[model samples]
Target chain A: MARKIVLIGPQRLQPTLAATVESLGVAGRIAAVTAGWEEREGEDRELHEHLGGRTTNLEAWTRVEDVMSADGELTGMIRQRADRLRAAHELYRLRLAHALDAARELLKREPQAGFEDLLEAEREAALRAVRVVDASHLERVSAIHAEFGAEAQPARRTSIRKHRAELEAQLKPCELLCIAGGHVVVLLHRLALLDVLGLWGERRPIVAWSAGAMALAERVVLFHDDPPQGAGNAEVYEPGLAAYSGLVPLPHARRRLRLHDGVRVGLMARRFAPDRCVALDALTRVEWDGSAWRGEAGTQQLDRQGHLTEVRS
Target chain B: MSGFVAELEQEARRGHHALEAFLRGRRFPVVDGRSVTFVWRGEADEVLLRHWIHGLPGGLPFHRVPGAGLWFLAIDVPEGSRVEYKIEVARWGERRLMADPLNEHHAADPYGANSVVHAQGYAPPEWIAHDAEARAGELREHAVRSQAYGGERRVQVYLPARFRTTRRYPLLVVHDGEDYLRFAALKTVLDNLIHRLELPSMVVALTQSPNRLEEYADDPRQARFLVDELVPELERAYPLVQKPAARGMMGASFGAVASLSAAWRHQGVFGNLLLQSGSFVFTDIGQHDRGPLFDPVVRFVNAFRRNPGRPAEHIYLSCGVYESLIYYNRSLMPLLSKSGMTVRFSESHDGHNWENWRDRLREGLSWLFPGPLWMVYE
Candidate 1:
């Protein structure tokens, strides 16, 4: 089966992306890491204190440090499973070779005078006799971390940054990173984290959505704010994220954020890069394959309406 | 075999990706994909309307839950009627000629309109058209006035389907224009009543309220708004008698109150009176006794003793025991009868809701002018 990316609606999809990074067990090659958890102080003060009780509930903050600790275990399991599958396939191939030898030695008349007749007579009989591997053996080698459930806690935020030079001095292999919505807000913090892990010098896959989706582009925009409301009626506020331009070659969410920005943003873009345009609905996506990045996003080629566009055709 | 139906469960399990994507900026684990709904939540709680939007351009499918009868999806609808709907099925597409198995309240589709009901407790009416056309005229400018007080308002009008430009027809005013002409399907009612000779061939003006509460309180402003605006507006659209006795007023609830008040204040303009659950004791409501409203009812009653009035030659009053103001209706009935007002009083065991008032409207028509069941005004 192919590996797939699952997404929820724009609002909820943010936390899910965060969970995947936690599971990876590495935030670059950084030696130390910390994550801010969005939380609410509740009626029960004890529960609040225990939000991220290290060994008990790692959810109080981002589990970058705890995640790195599990990296060795996951890497070892993956290698072991890959080796086991290769060994099993090799053993099966050896048995077939032995059977081929037996059939050839018995059937050859004048030292392979006629190949077709020998194989039809010998191979057909051997295949009927063969019954090799069990179903359980294949299943064991093929289990992909199948199920994951994510729960939403109240929103609390903290930032973690790492020293790139130190991380590079210690790392041996590479890693991948994905970001969305909330991640976009704290790009500077992420850069600090990524820089420390820069030691790996390995290929990284970066996927961003909404704000996180927009930050990967040349610039970032703040789209929403609370409007004038009546007494007791409050408006919700969503601050904008920092911007970063350089990344790998992939169809990422570059132009998608602008699809929802509407007309005003179009004028803003014309002033900035008159050349660089954004999609209207914020549905832009980019994909990179190591060397070069290719992307498809944005609503209008003529005007700059920074709305997000839909992902699928 | 398109296998579209089979794909539905798979599509749902996959979070309607086959339909649309998740919001950007959110990581959606597989488990969170379930329990997603498209309709926006939160709004005022005045009226409840259940609709099927599964049809393209947005729709809710007309699907039947297992073991549950048709009305599995119903909402709580208000008493007033000015509703729109389109039947939507998953695979077949949006059906214009859809029927409501839940709502017993049937309205007219003058502009190929649709029938709808509240999402819950949707019981289809006994007499809904199974094969009616969906293209019906639109509903507009249909409110009636209250006569007892001077400051109340409402929308109501009478329309003769095949009215001749040169001819004039006797006008028949019915309470609750929305309920009678729209929800109750008065055009169809008149079609049947006039053809059978159970009622006369007359123009019907179904009354409506401004705020409903304002109309019920017997506010004089609402009354003027109705007479000055609604009556003239309906008259321009449909041929109606400008004189009082030639006109009729009818309603139930505050609708009943408004009808009595309209005739009380403008008996010279509206002669016939039809009251269902009329609140005659305006003393309780702030609208009555404001300036000179209390005098109109008493003076009308006293004036009836002398000349018996040219406008009130025909009057009908009916109330249910469960209604809050039925006693006042009962008390006023005796006084109107003593004043030589030709009053037709009826009693039924029901509440002050649409169902009771609607049933009384059916009776009021018969009592006023007995005729064939299908002698329509047109």
Candidate 2:
């Protein structure tokens, strides 16, 4: 059976997770994941209260560490993946900066021949260059994941098998999975490593908020229009679990995006065109009901035309 | 002779009643130039007006009108001064704070209230009063199920008198909608503003949150419900301008946070924002003594300060100089401006309340929704 997944923005002031669980009628115990907190993962007392004490932490990070201690080759392979990913990100960062600068510069400059069509065509071409760079970076990251998956699973390290078995056992009695927010990359890493997504899809409802919400998207795009240093660009950090597609969850959007600038707002909408961009603030809940997306009253989406509109189910 | 004597007593009683009515009839504390006269009738050996004026201690005591059961006080004050005071009714050596019953206007604080006195050139606009000649807007109530909140909530929509389906109108959404309507006299203000062509004919939707504290605090589900459910319903029911720039969200205190949060999440939906005395409690800055209840608010503000996004195309942020949240709101202004958002900020010599928010509507709404004539003139 297909599972129900709800994504939201940040959950600081108003938490809808507990209410969401009750609404879903999942009265049984929930398997929880808070590996994003890193060292502070055990801090689930407040969360447990919200869930009526029907939650248990999966501790996937601890399991990952155990696996690394047990298996030398797998640990080495993991380190290699991390090093390569860093290098790829560093290289992509430089290219992306140059590509974006060129695009903006082209848009601002007047045509040498004074033909309006020439300027339009060149501007389109410049934008395409940025897309190309983005696409290329994604491909390299995808290849790395595929290679790791192909080699690691067949080897079947003892620690990995033990952890997988233990995870399945812990999840067996739980009727649902609740994901909390912290560090997006760390959360994503733990969830992916433990195969929690695969396990939950088979049975049980999935309710996630904040960073958890970001991890459900097709691609996790890190964006902050106004940063301490200066204007920042939106970058595709990593691929998401793709539990929910064609939806970009922008959490703490008030603190991040430059929605006032039509050029920037429109470009962002166009950059991820065909896919709708939704603001995932607190008390914001969107559920994929096996067909269409349903949401609350104030949930807004960036339309394909680069304008913001209220999202309807 | 005995019957005639009884008739004379009845006549005297009627005359005294008339005199009492006449004295209470006129607008209290009549102002002319710098001299203001306060009048009160019906027994009290000593009636004192306790005011916060410089060089006045224990208030100016009222003198009894000999053989009239009336107490009157006349004092000279500076022109263009607005004063808030309470009447101290002293009887049997006991004093009690009381509002001037004759004065229709009053300033309110969290602790009870006080009578308001506006000197010459310091009064609120006349347009705030309901005019018989003006056509009033109609308010329609609606209740819709929100998947974000997983419950049903009420939405009150205000349509201008000349609302027509043939044309699309801009949308103005307000949080704590009922409080604004009752306390701020929002409906009356809107009617006058629209009638005098101060602002455009707009469709205002006042949304009520089930859990105002929970819903207003940088919550994502609140944004989701606003955008996905409530908006779609509104769009279907009304002829609205289907663009972000034609829409706005407004609120006071936490409601301000909700307004900004909704706009921030869905910038494409709401292009304009009016925030009044927003509770942007930041731990990195000033005192955050609100404890756990404000933890999320602080976290959200901290995160925003770290990266203040330009959510709306035009933002009007107003704060009271006397409010505890003033420092935080002032600090937030720079971050918002730096986001490249066209920000207009103003401060008033007031505190966090509905009146402060009401006073701001004229400026905020006019600027955000300036009609054809204002656009051309300005």
Candidate 3:
């Protein structure tokens, strides 16, 4: 499907959200997903002002809660899935951390006797181990989704189907979809529940930043290098809508990642091999026009060798 | 009568009342009676104070005290207002601009020198000043060569008064070392904190940058020099904690970037990071950043977020509320915290300068090291 989306980094105080939407030239009614704001879901006044005051905040979290309240069985299933997911993620993170540590330590060792070839082999194996864990987690998640679909409970389908219809009705008049950054997991969950990607027609221009930008990727990767307390890991959390695939958007990259280390940069580039690791700093905007993606000045992509190269055109 | 008139009368009898009320030793803008006096000691026909008020520039003529070399002007400035001013001395038929020699507080500007007046409630902590009563630390200098940068850099090591070769201490590597040492009065602050048993006795290394912008803004070479060369040298010479959590990196502005970069490159090498008024410029953010200088910085910060491998143990971030970088720093706190770091954030009623960074050192460093966790006050 053709995709028309602009992914922004973080907006912080210097908000480029409104200007970005206006620049798209599709100036009409806008539908927004602000589930990322969590408790501050109704706080869309600032966003509305930026979007020329013609905005509708789809309270998708409320819809999810409604669906759960309507169907106890589905609610139970969701709770089970969440608990299992949390448990699995704990183990997955532990395994991934151990493997990554080993891989990094191996990379740190001084070269000796066919060390380049041997190191390459070891790196591949380490990456493979990490990938295996990620694959298994994805499989488990898929299985849960499969079971939910196969159950064929009318109430479950009806609850989701009604919400989908409501969301579609709300989106029908909107010319653009504006996604604001907040809690990624909440935003992603709400977007998935609302089936936003499915409802968002291919021709419509979509503007998103921060966590919202991350949710449009093929796989959402969560990362933070110098967190306050614990060491942050770049992990493949879950599958995105895949509406806009191939690039991983890192919002607030300056504050989160350790981009100065070539080894770390190269390792990240290699881990997500083939898919470009894109840096979406504040004011950075990248547009995907169906076939090819374009970036504004100062946009950067991680090269295979670990250096940050500017995104041209 | 009123408290103001009574205080005025009391001050009049004190002889050096003006100097005592306004000038604290040499610094100016000390409050006396509902007014903050700006004092300048120089030979001139006229001395004018130029500053902005309510978005408008205003110049006030300094009053030359009778038969005294001091030219003084008092302004009713609200408490906690940070203002920059330059003294325009009209002499030799030409007016000359001069920074306040007595005030050590100033903003970082490449254009011109301007002295900063930290009004009431905005002044830096009094502990930073050199106090004879406070036990001082010894700062030893060393010159180390870096194969990565292909240059020699000066590094100053601060050893706590009770330092012992047998006892291992946490190593804190500070970027822009000399600036922090000179401007921030870090040695004196460390001395006071350590003497008061507020902070644990730790080893501090202040490393001067060859070229701050080139080396600190996401430079792998500088990162290598820090993690590979400098850190190793320090470990060899001093009994330092080998664990990354036991090692710390501290710097203000670009130096903060250097510290973060080093810790990021060599994970498990540095667990603690104290970033004061860090110039964490991202590509799209920090509109007021140095155009070309911010290019690499933006790139590096972006990349780190994208591939955050593992976080440091304890990350401490402190920035001034009045600085331009405040928005950038505040935005970064949540992101860093979300990345799973035990982050302690603090803000000062100051701007992006050494004094601002110095003022928050006690809070930031104490939390990171928590050395005096068990210390009891007598």
Q: State the lDDT of candidate 1 residue by residue for A88-205, as single tens digits.
A: 5455445544543443343332436658686556544542333122122233323321210011110111212232333343343334333333323233233323442233233444
Error of 2 at B15 (Å): 55
Q: Per-residue lDDT for B1-378 in model 1, tens only?
A: 113323333444565343233322322111111121111111211112233221212343333322211111222222322233544332234222344423343434324444432222223333323223112222335534444444444444444333444445556655557665655565665654443334544666555544565554555654565566666766786665676656666776667666666555555666677787765553432344424544444343333334434446678888766455666678777667877778888875444445555556556766665542211100
TM-score of each: 0.31, 0.45, 0.47
Reference-based lDDT, residue B211, model 1: 52
Give the per-residue Cα lDDT of candidate 1 at B242.
72
TM score of chain A per candidate: 0.33, 0.90, 0.92
CA shift of A129, model 1, Å: 99
Write down the worst ten-residue block by lDDT for model 3 chain B: B369-378
Interface RMSD of 2: 19.9
Comparing 1 with 3 on lDDT, the higher-scoring candidate is: 3
CA lDDT of each prediction against the hidden true structure: 0.40, 0.77, 0.76
Output the lDDT of residue B178, model 2. Answer: 86
Fnat values, candidates in order: 0.00, 0.00, 0.00
- Note the DockQ of each predicted structure: 0.00, 0.01, 0.01
